[model samples]
Target: MSPERGRPPRRAVVRAARRGLGYMPGTLLIAAVAGVLGLSLGAGGVPDVVPAGGGLTVNDVTSKAFGQHAPGLPIGELRHFTIGNRLFNTNWVIAPASVRSLDGLGPYFNRVSCSACHVRDGRGRPPAGPEAPMMSMLVRLSVPGPDGTPAAHPIYGEQLSDRAVEGLAPEGRAAMTWEPLAPFVYADGSVVPLRRPRLDFVDMADGPLGPGAMTSARVANAVFGLGLLEAVSEAHVVARADPDDANGDGVSGRVNRVWDHDAQALALGRFGWKANQPTLRQQAAAAMAGDVGVTSEHFAGGNYTAAQTDAAALPNGADDEGVELSRKQLNRLTFYLQTLAVPARRDTHNPVVQRGEQLFGAAGCNACHTPVMQTGATAAHGVLVDQTFAPYTDLLLHDMGPGLADGRPDGLASGREWRTPALWGLGLQKRVSGHTFLLHDGRARNAQEAVLWHGGEARGARDRFARWPAEDRAALLAFLDSL
Candidate 1:
């Protein structure tokens, strides 16, 4: 239910009151008492507080809209959303151990849970305290092949696992640093600095990391509304592809078709910056298996070596084999991701915000970060359609300049290319969420930093932003946050 945008029934109410006033005071009081008693007894229902034919204020519309879609989710389906929240919370701060049964936990991995990096399921900012600057966020790096393609390392390789068994600590610790660059002053006099990210990791003390070792780094992303991204049809994305840059805009869009184990074929990539993983299901499975080292039927073989496998050393019940996640649990996780609602916009009508929106369009930011695509009708979740989604991403890979490049390619994303991330959740970032680490390397500590770090095809826009006036620049940022 969208808001009621029609006229109010004020005249009708006024006439009804006039007639009621003519009734004796005693009779009116008795009638009012009877109405209260009926409501207490759960008669038909409480008359609509909003009242029929009434003009809906913004608050009324929002409260009602929220109740219809979220706050008052229909029964039965509530489990899907609620269970999704639980799984999210579980994965948020606590990692699933590689070898866990009903008894307990595992062999090898990185941090315990998703929240370790993402923190409050929001954005991750810069490294502070004792944590190394590289510790601002973890990047997953795999070595490149002779052809320059990213491939898993042969042995004593793959992603660096920092946690291992009882006696042995995990091998491979990545240490990184940040070097800030000069602030670029925009046309409007707004200035923002850029950040350069550098990485170095140590291999196992007892062993040697082979030549084919592959590396990739991941800055944690908020898991809000990912399901919508996943649900967006391949046809819609492929149609947006301007592979040859035929539009003459120099911005060519392409889909990252990747291996899909569930579908048992190649499918459109939607999740990662590379679009490397096909679905939320595959992404979650890999995260569980690779990041936390928890093996499941989805990733049966696991991404580690015998020397690297933790169960043998740590001594936990073997969840990798018999105790795997059920389809229900997996689906719940996906559902929660899909339904994680975008936060309500603040001050969308502010003049600054309106101007910023217009400037955003003029700035060509919308060329790639295209906005407003209506979700098609669906039986299970009607909320997908007509639901204003502000994911300011075309979900296609783009050649960001050298400044933003991590030099580690994955599937379809070249070292210079990455899938556009959604910008809708910025309003709550590092607030209800935490950290403002933007971009793949987590080097850009804030929005301005991220913008300043843009390069390659975005260089022109970056330059433009560098010269934007302070007030206009504030409007631009305001526009971004209003997403």
Candidate 2:
């Protein structure tokens, strides 16, 4: 809640908080301060037993954009380069042209190049350069379990993938049609339509999608500050789960746990809808398999049929199906993803942008799309704590309405759940090679359409947005672009 929301004034909230913590022993006081700010004093910085909220306020939170970086990781100098050269021309090796070709592109692949999906290791939009929306991206799907529970992944033949490594096995295609609702009119008269996608995946005639034939529609989300977000302690995440909606806010925030088959244990999901993958290593490696049809240590084999896996054209890595992923490649991709920095926030001075930020909080967007958070330490990445980050997402999945459901379950995430995407790095849209295709499934032509599609738990917030004035509406869009 904002400091101004309570009946009490700013000073009163601060004062009451101070008195409430007055009895905390010195050790607890020091720990409390460290938990929130995580900053050190000068060279001799020792724990200050001072009361919390000495002068913190909304404005005070304005400059808090620098989140903690994983300590040991190198902060490479991001010297600029052309989009093709920096993102497309080379492979994950960062060598001159190590991984440039599509040699292992698929037994059921979406695109030929990593850059094909992720425009500049940045954001990708709909109709990415006039490509069909389905080619723009494909999601995973599966059928329900015997007990009628949602299935995260296809238990049998793959859920959805169009291309193949050797033209040897079952491949599926995804098609989408839009149903537009009535236009939304602001008090000042700007209109926007609320559209949802009814996706159809077909042509998997070679086999049946197993246990649960569910689908997860995904497009490349902005990759920024992944390492820092990874380093956040599980304790901090559990601290926020409100699955039962005990607060009566109509929003039930749930945490999803995933099975890291590679790690061989259940892990708290930190990526994908329902937090399906536990860490960047797992997510990146699996992408090597699903997105590129390349076998990795984690995925071990291509998403090919038994016959396709035996095809001579299969890559060196897939000789033995279901083998382990390449640990070396996993590390490299994880390194690249983790090192990607969050773009600086833009447009803070515009009145509309400022109002949007205010409304974002007022409408409870911040509760899920939290403006900031800190990271903790990890041996692989040190000094992750104390630094501040502005991811604009809590990395938790929320219950979006049926309009957005893909009917694919993974781990703890139901078909209707999706992770809150981070809004940082959004302003660079115009710089990439493609058009501004926003929203999952590339359905919303732009940011405005994206906002209007909100429903389910977000219905209240979307309704509030629908009733907003034109200037206020513009403010919200401005705030979103500022990310």
lDDT of each: 0.58, 0.57
Question: In candidate 1, what are the lDDT values of residues 119-143, reduced to their tens digit?
Answer: 5455555454223533324556567
Off by over 4 Å in 2: 1-104, 127-133, 147-159, 166-170, 187-189, 202-212, 305-315, 318-325
| Residue 197 Cα positional deviation in candidate 1, in Å, after optimal superposition | 1.9
Instruction: List, in order, the clash count of every candidate structure.
Output: 32, 33
**lDDT of each residue in 1-483, candidate 2, tens digit only:** 111111334464344334434546534653543444333432323332211111111111121222112224334412211221233323332112333332344556666556566655655554323225454466666566577765434332434667654545536566666667788676767666666566565565446454335566677765546766787788878787788889988777788898777679887898754577888878876776777666666676556545443443444433233332345445655656655445455555544454455556555676677666666555234334445566666777788898777656677877788777766655545444244556667676667776677777778888887775554555567667766
Q: Model 2: what TM-score?
A: 0.74
| C-alpha lDDT of candidate 2 relative to the true structure | 0.57
Could you estimate the TM-score for every candidate? 0.77, 0.74
